[model samples]
Target: MRADNSQHIVEAARRRSEYTRSKAVQALRALDAAGEPVTFETVAKQAGVSRSWLYAQPDLRAEIEQLRAVQRRAPRSSVPARQRASDASLRRRLETANERIQRLTDENRQLRAHLAGALGEQRAARSHTSPRGAASMHEGVDIADPVQPQQPIREREQ
Candidate 1:
């Protein structure tokens, strides 16, 4: 008859269970500390244990559920509440941007009107200098170069 060795086998099983439990607890702590999501799958993977085994542990299961709930309720942003910009600050920035856009639009409109008037004056000067039925004096002139008026020379009175 074989000698009874059930006691030794039972002792080894208990030790294995204790070791596994400790590993799961450590994994839970690590995940919580790192601000990572605390799910049973995550804890099981980190601990190198089976999900079924983690679910069987009542204390760990409860803690995991509580942490998961808390995480769901908490904000997901990495930035702390104190460092976030206020609503008023955002609104003021938007208003300033809009004002700058309006000012630039007005400036662009005035510049375009001034350019049109100068081009009209240049065309009139070209027409007056060219006789009827003759080629225009400004035929080869580039429109981009604005026409400058010749200043009248004032004679000094002796």
Candidate 2:
């Protein structure tokens, strides 16, 4: 009688083992069909088994390692497009700002040179004038000759 009970228990355990193995295999096939990475956690979760079970199973553990290796060797060239576009925009804006700054700097230098030349000419004219007229000439406002006031060099150029 005891032998009969022992055989029954052994048979039941074997059936349970076969069911677990079948579940793991089915999960692995589904993952492969979906082109998903077959890791221990993924397989265990899909198969409704514990992670320890997968780790303890030599075949499953080896398969998971092989899949992980394949994942590492796979080519991944998926960069975020928005980030690339933003970087390009930042570069263009920086170039434009630099160009504007260079133009303004050149304009400032030209204006300074023109101011120096005008001052030099005024000094030479003062040297040829009488002292009485020279003192009055330095004033920007022409009190006596307001009818025909002096025009600036920029306006004369136009």
TM-score of each: 0.48, 0.45
Assess candidate 1 and give its TM-score to the true structure.
0.48
Q: Write the per-residue lDDT of candidate 1 for residues 77-116, one digit (tens) a residue.
A: 3433334468899999999999999999999999999999
Clashing pairs in 2: none
RMSD of each: 13.2, 15.4
lDDT of 1 at 144: 30
Candidate 1: where are CA atoms >4 Å away?
77-158
Error of 2 at 70 (Å): 0.3
Residues 7-94 of candidate 2 have per-residue lDDT tens digits of 8899999999999999997897677556677778899999999999989999888877776566556523232212234667889999
